[model samples]
Each structure stands twice: as structure tokens, then as C-alpha cells.
Target: MKIKRSAATIIGEVSALILTFLTHWVVFYFIIINSFKTRAEAARLSLAFPKKWQIIENYSYILSYGDGLFFRSMWNSIRLTIISIVILVLVASMTGYIMQRRQGKFSKISNKLILAGLIVPPSVISTYWILSQLGVVGTLAGLTLVEVATMFPFSVMIYKGYMATIPRDIDAAAIIDGCSASRLYFQIIFPILKPITATIVILRSVVVYNDFANPLYYMSGARNSTIQLFVYTFQSAFLTQWNYLFAAIVLISLPPFILYLILNKRILEGVTAGAVKG
Candidate 1:
């Protein structure tokens, strides 16, 4: 009975893996093959291979489009992503640590608010009004703040979970050694949080980089557009340049795809560390 059950489990796992691979590969293949095709060929959106590859033309045009708007958008995306992640990591990690260590009414209320942040749907109109009042509605700084706010709750939760696994004896020892509160957290605790920090950074970098809606709502115009918005140049109400669009998508997707491939194991390890290690 045990042997049969083991065989059944193995078969189920293999089947799920094959299905996932095929599903993802088909989408990947379609986008890539279309990216190399001519505008007319790509418009058809068929599964067939391109008769004449326009690799250089398609990719080059996308790069040089609108006096290098693509490059500008790419830079904007990188900048926004970096700024947001740094702020989020600093603020969220500290907040998580405090919430875990301290016990009081304020901490309890803060915890509830964090949970509310995760559950509540954000209001674009209200956010716009607030940003408009502050005159940061269309700037990178405004968008950076928005991204940080949006990602805060999840990061805090992750940190809090992982922080629980760390023994309180460490805190007691550090306090006994004449460490100030700030020093204890920043010097002792923060360094120890490398695993969770890495998890938050890698995971949130991908999210902020690939974000479409937040950028669309908070920031506007060609000058301030992110990579996701850069794709809009190839699309229109009357007509869509399918090949150029696909090429732009390929370029936008590469960073996150490469990141996931390189750190996939680390991401898994970080996420599971709290649960498994403790």
C-alpha cells in the first residue's frame, strides 16, 4: 500500500510539473517568436515561425523609438524601483522588528492597521487627490512613496514572521551589553535579518519594476513613464504595432525574468525560512 501511494504521489507531481512547464512555455514561445517577426506577420498572432526574421529592425526600432524614450523609461523604472525598495526595506524592517519586540496598545493598534492595509483596496481617486494637494502627483517621488506604501504591509508581515523565529535571548544579551535601542536594532538585529531582507528586496524589486497600474495612476506623460508604460507607444485606438509591442514586452520582461531565474532558490529559501527553521 505504501509503495503504491508513493508511486501515485510521484505521478501526480510529474504531471503537475509538465502541465505548468507547457503552459508557461507556450506563452513564452508565442511572445518570443512574434517579437522576431515583421509587423504584418506579428499581427496575425499565429503559432507559425516567421518567414523572415526582423530581429535587428524590431529591437532597434524599439530602442530608438521616440528619441530613445524606451531608454528613458527604463532609467525611470530602475530609479523608482531602487528608491522604493530602499525606503521599504528600511522602514518596513524597522517597523516589523518593533512590532514583534514591543508589547503595548500602540503596537496592537499598529498591527491591526497593517492588517487593514493588506485587506483594504486602495482608492486611486483619493490617492490622486492627496498627491495633488501635495503637488507630487506626477513626479517620481510621489510614485516612490506610493509604491512603498502599497508594499509595506506584506514586507512587515514577512519580517514579523521571520523575526519571531529569532530568540529573545539575543535582545536580552544586547541590552545587557550597554546597547542603545537604535544600536540594538540597526547594528545587531538588522544584520541578522539578511535572509528576510534579501527576500523582501528581490521580491519587491520585481513587483515595483513591473508595476503598471500604480505608475499609470500616479505618474503620467512620456517623460515620466516607466518601462511598462513605454509599451503604449506601439499601441493605439486605431492601430496597434504588434511586433513592436511584443519586442517592447520582451525588453521590459527580461530584468524580472533573469532576476527570478538567478534567485529563485533564494526566494524560496527566504520565504520558507521562518516556517522551517523555527
Candidate 2:
């Protein structure tokens, strides 16, 4: 039997789509339009095209500003992201696999703690104090640790939920075939986890890359800054230079945007597969 769609449902769907389009259009329009305008024109924050386009000048100035500080910040962001993701993937995968496979009081308690981490916010002052005691308070390494720790709980939950779907027969079979626990997980089980892993990688990478609050709190004293920090500093220094600021925003946004475009299909597949399996 064919079910007919109601008029209200159709209207609601259309309204939702229009709202979504307008939201994205307004944001991109502001960024792209202002990016091409002169400082005075951009200051107006107008939706119109620039009377005198200064694309080249604006971009050039941003790139060369403060001895190429933008590029430095970009590199810092890349480094921090890479380190954080690598550690997160390795640690979370292992922890999740263990938590899912091992049935005991310990696992139950650990699960509760991990869930609590999701609900609770970290104390910035306490974290700062710990880092200071470790003598890495103002260093990139310290910030990397903070990022990995912050992201670990969510990543582990994703992996653990996905691991629940895998049959215990696989583990028993691998063990009977003389595979050690480490070898079994790394060689056999990890391969099966590719879909969920891809989801974690894409989602967590975006979060860590675009993170502003963690870096702001933990890395304020660092000599080199992350891309977001650089933007904040640039805004303060060039308070009236809206054109340059917008240009910088566009450039900084390109890397993650390009990454998402390239891997969007995989991201969707991974997320859906994880959700269904979990």
C-alpha cells in the first residue's frame, strides 16, 4: 500500500530546507563578500560586491603580516592536530576494545567514569596547575596532552560501541590460531574497525583542528600560536583592518573545508555504519 504524504509535512520539509540554505548562504556570503572588499567597504559589512576589489592586496598583506605569523600558526595547528589524532586513535582504540571485551566490575566502573567525562567540563585552573607542575605549562607538548585527554572519552565510546557488534568467535578463533592478544587486535580486529575509525578520525580531526577554547586556555603563554589563536591576535592588532581579517579567515578555513569535501562520502558511510552496528 502506498502512503500519501500530508500537506503539512511537505510544507514543513520545504521550510526546513529553505532555512538551512539561507543560514549557510548568509555565512558564506559575508565571508566571501567582505574578503574582497576594502577596509572601509568591509567595515560596513555590506552584502554587496566591493567598489574597489583588493583581493590580492588583502591576501598578500595577511600572508606577510608580522613576518608571516599566519603561516607559523598554521604549522603549529597542523602539528598539534597530527599529534593529538595519532595518540587519540591508538589509545582510544585499545581502551575501547579492552573495555568492550573484558567483562568485570573494573570495566563497569571505567565505563561510568568515561560517561562522566562526557558530561563534565574540565577545570582550567586545575589543568593549568598540573601542567605547571610538569614544567610543560606553556609548551605545545602540554597543549597536545590536554587535547588528547579531552578527546579521549568520546573517541573511546565510539570505538567501544562499535566493538560490541563484533562476534566473540573471531577472538576465540584468532587465539586458537596462536595469535597473541596484541597481534589479534592489531592485525585482525583493527581491520574490521575501519569504518568506525574513519568516522572518529574525520569528526575528531575537525573538532581538534577548529578548537578555540582549549588552546586559548592552555596555550596563552606559548610563543607560537595555533591558527585560531593567530586569528584572535590578528583581530586585536588589526582592529580596524576588516579586509585583512576576512582574508585571513578565508585562508585559514580552506584546509579543513578541503579535507571535508574530499572525505565527506567516507565520513557519512562510517557514521551511518557505526550508528547501525552500535
Candidate 3:
């Protein structure tokens, strides 16, 4: 059956798109335009296009700043994002699979804990203290672990929801063929989970890559900085160079934006599938 949309519904949808454009696209345009301005001109922070473009100079300065600290920070952010995503995918997927397949006291307790994780805001002080005790504070490994922990609960929920949609009969069949539990999951179930995995990867990759607060809290020092933290180098008490700051922002924002553009469809599909299935 086909349904006809009301005029009001069409108008509402169009209005939402216009609003989104004004809020997001307009802001992006403002940032891009300002990034090309002189330090004094950028300080004005107006939507007007730059009268004098310092395109190459601004970007080059940002790239070559602090003996190429920006590049090092970029590498650090990338490494953290990749490591976190890999661990989250493997651990969360298996945990979700087990939680879905097994129903018992342990599963119940775990579900409650995950629920709590979603609701509870983690204490930065406590987390830092714990990391300090573990002797991992200010290290990439510690930061990676924190990133994975932060993302784990939601990832597991998505995996568990999607896992429920997969028939248990498949597991029975695989087992009947002498597939071990680990083999069945890795070879069969894991491959089938690519869609959700892609969704998780793109979404979480952006979060981890763009994360400023966690990195600031857990990982200190210039050498340990992530791309987001590299922005601080542009500011000081005496003066702030808005042009260089905006330019750096533009450069750092590109990777995640490009990634989203490439895999945007998977995000909606995965979320919707998990929602409907679970």
C-alpha cells in the first residue's frame, strides 16, 4: 500500500533541513572563511569572507608549528582511535554474543552494570586516581584502555541487540558440523557482523579522534597530546591567534568528516536494524 504525505508534513521536513543547514553548514562555512583570514581579521569572528586570504601561510604555520607537533598529535590520535576500536569491537561483540546466548545470573548482573554505565557519569578524579594506581596515567596504553571502556557499553548494547536477530538455529547447525565455540563465532558470526561493526567503527572512530576532554584529563604533556589537544598550542594568556587556530581546526576536522561521508549509510542502517531487531 502507498500512503500520501500531507502538505504540512512536507513543509515540516523542509523546514528541518533548512534549520539544519543554517545551524551546521552555516557554522562550517563561517569557520572555513575565518581560517583564511589574518590573525586580526579572524579575531572579528564575522561570517564575512576574508578580504585578505592567508590560505597557504596559515595552514603551513599550523603544520610546521612546534617542530611538527601537529603531525605527531595526529599520529597519536589515529593510533588511539584504531586501538580502541579494535578492542571495543572484539571484546564488546564477544561479550554481547555471550550475554545474548546465555541467560543466567551473570548475564543479568552484566546487563544491570551496562545499564548503570549508560546512566552514570564517570568521575574524572576517580578515573584518574584509578589509572594512577594502575601506573598507566599519561601513557597511550592507558588512554586507549579508557577510550575502549568509555565506548564499550553502548557497543555491547548494539551488538547484543543485533545478535538477538541472528537465529540460534545457525549456532546449532554450526556446532553440528563440529565447529568449536570460538571458531563458530570468529569464522561465522563475526563475519556476519560486519555491518554493525562498520557502523560502530565510523561512529566511535569520530568520537575517539575528536575527544579532547578525556585526553586532557588522562594524558598530559606535549609529546603525549592528541590532535584535539594540539589546538591549545595556538592560545596563550597574552594573545590568541584565531587564524592559526581555525586553520588547525579545519585540518583536524577533515579526517572524521571524510570518514562519515564514506560510511554514513551504515550508521543509520545499523542503528535502525539494531533498534527494530532488539
Candidate 4:
């Protein structure tokens, strides 16, 4: 049997979609238009097209400014994101597998703790103090740890939920094949975890790459800055240059946008699979 939507329902859905598109496009329009304007024109923050287009000049200046600090910051963000994602994926996947396969008091306690991690906000002061004690407060390594720790709980939950849909017979068969625990997971189970892993990688990469607050709070003392922090350099007490800022914003936004465009199909598939299975 085929069910058709009424005219009223179709109109409502269309109206909602148009409203959503306009809402997002308005903000994107402001950023793009201002990016092409002169500093004075951008400062006005008008929605009109630029009176004097300075797109090339603005982009060139932004790229060349501060001895190429923008690119350096981009590199820093890339390094952080890469390291953090690798560590998060490995540790979270393994932990989730263990928590799901092993049923015990310890697992129960761990589940509660993981749930607490999701509910509770991180304590900046305590985290900084711990990093200070470890003598890594101002280093990239420490910031990477922070990102992994903060994102771990959510990733674990996602993996654990997906893992529940897997049968124990697979594990039994792997063990019967004389596979070591490590080999069983690494060779067999991990490969099967591709769908959920893809979802985690895509979603968490965006968060870690674009993170602003954590870098500001934890990495403020560091000499190197992430892309988000680098963009803040455009602001000053005397005057704020909106054109240069918008130009930098556009440039910095490209990497993640391109990444999404390339992997959008995989990302959507992974998410849908996780949703259905989990």
C-alpha cells in the first residue's frame, strides 16, 4: 500500500525547510559578504553586497600576516586533532568492547563512572592543576590528553551501544580458532566496528578541530596556538578589523567543510547503521 501526504502537510514541511535554509544562509551570507568588503564596510556589518570588493586583498593579507601565524596555527590544530582522534578511537573502542563483553561488578562501576563523565562538566581548575603536577600544562601533549579524556565518554557510549548488537558466537568462534585476546579484537572485532568507528571519527573530528574553549583555557600559556585561537589575534582594544577576521574565518572553515563534503556519504551511512543497530 502507498500512503500520500496531504497538501497541507506538504506545504508545512516545505515552509519549515525554507525557513531553516534562510536562517542558516543569512549567517553564511553575512560572513561571506563581509569577507569581501573593505575593513570600514565590514565594520558596519551590513547585509548588502560590498561597495568595494577586497576579497583578494583581504585573503592575501590574512595569509601573510604575523609571519604566517595563521598557517602555523592551522598546522597545530591538525596535529592535535590527528593525535587526539587516534588515541580516542583506540582507547574508547577497546574500553567499550571490554565493558560490553565482560559482565561484572567492575564493569557496572565503570559504566556508572562513564555515565557520570557524560553528565558532569570538567573542572578546569582541577584539570589544570593535574596537568601542572604532571609538568605538561603548557604543552601540546597535555592538550591532546584533555581532548581525548573529554571526548572519551561519548565515544565509548556510541561504541558500546553498537557492540551490543554483535553476537557472542563471533567471539566464541574467534577464541576457538586459537586467537589471542589482542588478536581477536584487533584482527576480527575491530574490523567489524567500522560503521560506528566512522561515525565517531567524523563527529569527534569536527568537535576537536573546531574546539575553542578548551584551547583557550588549557593552552593559553602555550606559545603555539590552534586555528581557533589564531583567529582571535585579529581583535584589539583599539580597533577590530572585521574584514581580516572574516577572511581568516572563511579560510579556516575550509578544511572541515572539505572533509565533510568528501566523506559525507560514509558519515551518513555510519550514523544510520549505528542508529539502526544500536
Candidate 5:
């Protein structure tokens, strides 16, 4: 009876997993299917093969010749993601270290502030206040600042958790060896933080890369659009020409997609290490 029950449970779990895989396959299949056609095919034969099979033409049209602003969006997204994620990782590392190591009233308050920032949606009060003050409405710098502020808490929490597992003895030893705080971290603790750092890097990059609302609010011009914002406009505008839109999507999605694909192993390792150690 116990053996039968165990088998039943295993079968149920397998069935659920299979269902999830099928769903994912269907979604990706449609996305790929749309990328190889013109607007006519996308509208008329969404589920069928392309009329001309002009995958290159579809791709190039969006990129170079088509009525699309894909390349500009691609550049904007890449630049914003790289800059924002790098700053978040570095600043969050230092802030996380201090928050954990200091252990004072102020540190506790600061930690709570970060958590509050995370808990409250950025769209609520902060946007109103920031826009009212900094006059950063619809500017790249404003958007970058907001992104950093909103994303910092997650990185800090991850870093702090990972740092907790690291021995204070290491810090003491480094300090006794005449290592300054900056040198100690940059040399000793920083190296050990590789896994969580990679995890944060990939995670934050993905978030910033995929962001739409923030860009929509803060970025306007076709010349100044990020990938997500650009894709959004194209989707809204092109009711008929979906092939070019899909191709634009495919291009815009390549960077973060490629970055995660290449760094996936490191990202997993970092997350696993942080989890187990924390």
C-alpha cells in the first residue's frame, strides 16, 4: 500500500512537471514562429509556416530597413542595463557589508529602510516626490537613479545574507595583516562573494533589461527609447505588421537572454551558495 502511494505521488509530480514544460514550449514556439515572417503572414498565418520563409529579410527589416526603431532600442537597453546593474552591485555590496557588520541602531534603521523601499511599490509615493523635486521627469539619469533605488534592496539582502555566512575571522585576519577596509573587501571578502555577485548581476540585469513601465514614464523620444518601451509602442501601433514586431522583439531580447545563457551556471552557483551558507 505504501509503495503504491509513493508511486502515485511520484506520478503526480511528474505530470505537473510535464505540464509546465509543455506550457513553456507552446509560448516559445509561438514567439519563434512569428519571427520568421512579414506582417501579412503574422496576421493571416500566425500558426502556419512563413509564406516566403524570409527570416533574414524579416530580421534585417526590423534592424536596418524596416519601419522599426529596433537598433536604437537595443542600444538604449544594453547601455542602461549594464550601467545600472554594475552600480547596484557595487553600492549594494558596500552598504550590505556595513549594515551587517555595524550592528547599531542606525544600521538597523537603515536596513529597515531598505526593506520598506522594497515592500512599497516605487510607483506610489516616491515617483510623485522625486518628480516634484529633482525635475527628473522623462530623462535617462532620472530613470537610472530610480532603477538603482528600487533594485538596491534585493541586492543588499542577498549580499548581507551571503556575508553573514563568511567568518569574521577572515576580516580580522585581513585587518591584522595591515589590510584597509577597502582592500580587505576588494581582495578577501569580494573574491568569496563571487557566486552571489554573479547571481545579483544576472538577476538585476534581467530586471533592468525587461523594465517597461519605468521607461515608459521616464523615456519618450524614438531616439531615446529602451527595448521594452520600444517593443511596447510597436505592439500598440502595428496591428497588422506583427512579423517585423516579432523580429524587433527577438533582437531586443537577445542581450539579456544571451547574458543569462552564458552566466547561468555562475548565477545558479551563487544563488545556491548564498542559500546554503546563509
Candidate 6:
């Protein structure tokens, strides 16, 4: 039996939706409104729209810095995100499977260590010390390693949860068929892990792509700057050009944000699955 919608319920639902829409758009409005004005015009009022749209001018100014390093920084971010995600998937999948399937006292201790990484603040001092000792400061490899170490625990935890959900029968079947562990994982199990993989890709790619602090401490020089570090530099320049800054900010943030909108459902499922199994 279908129940008819009440007028009060419909009104309340519409009101709630309107409130949500306005709340979401208010900041968007601020940025989009300011993104059009000249520096003088943008500062005229906190909430004012541009009297004339200088969007192109602002973009030109932001992009004109140092022969267009903005594009190069984007390239760096893409490379870092891809490499880090691939490494995390491969290493974490195998490690999580082992830890979950081969449960033992030592595995429990190892699990605790991984959890410690999550609970504790990343040890800047220890990282700096390691960098100093290895003489790898200000290098791309150094920055990459730092990112992997800092981000590894989250991926491991997620993968461990997922490994729990995968049946041990799959492993046993592959073994009975004379398949090696590595072959079984990559050819069979890895394929089955796609849903969680999508989740990891969306979630971790955004984070590693957007992380600024790690790059600030580790990748200081211009030669190896990721997009996040590059964006920070744009923000802190002497002039504080609001229009150009917002334009660059929008450009910097567009890719990951677009990706989120597209794959948000899958990402949500991955997170939910991880939480449920974990």
C-alpha cells in the first residue's frame, strides 16, 4: 500500500534541501564571485561581484609566473599520485593478506605497529634525521619515500580489512591448482579486489596529490615541487593577489575534485566496506 505524501512533509523536505544548497554554495559563491574581479575591485566589498569580469586577466597573471611552472607542477602531482598509489596497492595487498591469513603472535605485534603509525603523529624529527643521515634531503626520491611512509598505514589498514572479507577458499583453490602465491594474488585475487582498489585510488590519490606540508618540509626546492607546494607558493607571494590566487587555486583543485564527483559512489562503498570489515 502506498501512502500519500503530506503537505507538511513535502514543505519540510524542500526547506531542508534549500538550506543545504545555500550552505554549499555560499563558499563557492565567495570564490567564484571574487575570481572575476581585479585586485582593486575584489577588495571593494567582501561579498561584491566583479563590476567587470577579469577572469582571463587573472588567469594570465597566475600562469605567467616563471615560464608557466603551474603546468609542470601538475605533471609532478600526477606522477607522484600514480607511483604512490601503485606501490601502495601492490605492497599493502600482499602484506595485508599475509597478516590476516597467517595470524600469529608476531602478526598481532606487527598489526599494532601499523596502528601506532596511524595513532601517532608522523615523526618529523625522525624523518628529518633519516634524511640527514642518508643525505637525501631536497631530492625527489626522498620526498616520494616520505609520502609513502606517511600514507602507508591508512592503505594497510584498509587492505587488511578487505583481506578479512575475502574468503580463504580462494587462496586454497589457487594453491591446489599449482599456482604460486604471487601469481594467485595478482591474477585472481587482485582482480577481485577492484572495488576496494577504486576506493583507495580515489581517496589516497586526492590526499597524496594535495598534501602540502610533507612537500614543504621535504621538497623545498623548485626543481621537484608538486602541485600542492606550488599552490602554497602562489598563496604566500608578496602581493596577495586575490583574483589570480583564486583562479590558480581553482585550476589546482579541479582534477581531484572532478574525480571525486565522478567516482564518489565507489569511493563511499570502499570506505564503508573497510569500516564494516575492519
The number of the candidate with the highest TM-score is: 3
Alpha-carbon shift of residue 261 in model 3 (angstroms): 3.2
Which residue window of length 10 is worst by lDDT in model 1? 269-278
List lDDT for all candidates, in order: 0.91, 0.87, 0.92, 0.90, 0.80, 0.81
225-249 in candidate 2: lDDT tens per residue? 8888777765664476778878889
TM-score of 5: 0.89
lDDT of 4 by residue, 129-198 (tens): 9999999887899999999999999999888888888899999999998999999999999998887787
Per-residue lDDT of model 3, residues 172-276, tens digit only = 999999999999999999998988988999989999998999999999888998999999878889889999999999999988888888888778777777776
- The best candidate by lDDT is 3
Colliding residue pairs in candidate 4? none
Tens digits of per-residue lDDT, candidate 5, 14-125, equal: 9999998779876677778988877777876456777678798887776764255677777788888888988898899988888888888998799889889789776745
Candidate 6 error regions (>4 Å): 1-23
Clashes of each: 0, 0, 0, 0, 2, 0
- Which ranges in model 4 have alpha carbons more than 4 Å from their true place? 236-238, 276-278
Model 2 segments more than 4 A misplaced: 1-4, 220-222
Candidate 3 off by > 4 Å: 1-4, 236-238
The model with the greater lDDT, 3 or 6, is 3
TM-score of 1: 0.93
Q: Between which residue pairs do clashes occur in model 5?
A: 61-66, 195-270
TM value for model 3: 0.95
lDDT of 2 at 126: 99
Distance from true location, Cα of 261 in model 5, Å: 2.5
Error of 1 at 151 (Å): 0.7
Q: Candidate 4 has what TM-score?
A: 0.94
lDDT of candidate 1 over 113-144, digit per residue (tens) = 99999999999999999899988989999999
lDDT of 6 by residue, 20-61 (tens): 878887777787778788888776537776778898888887
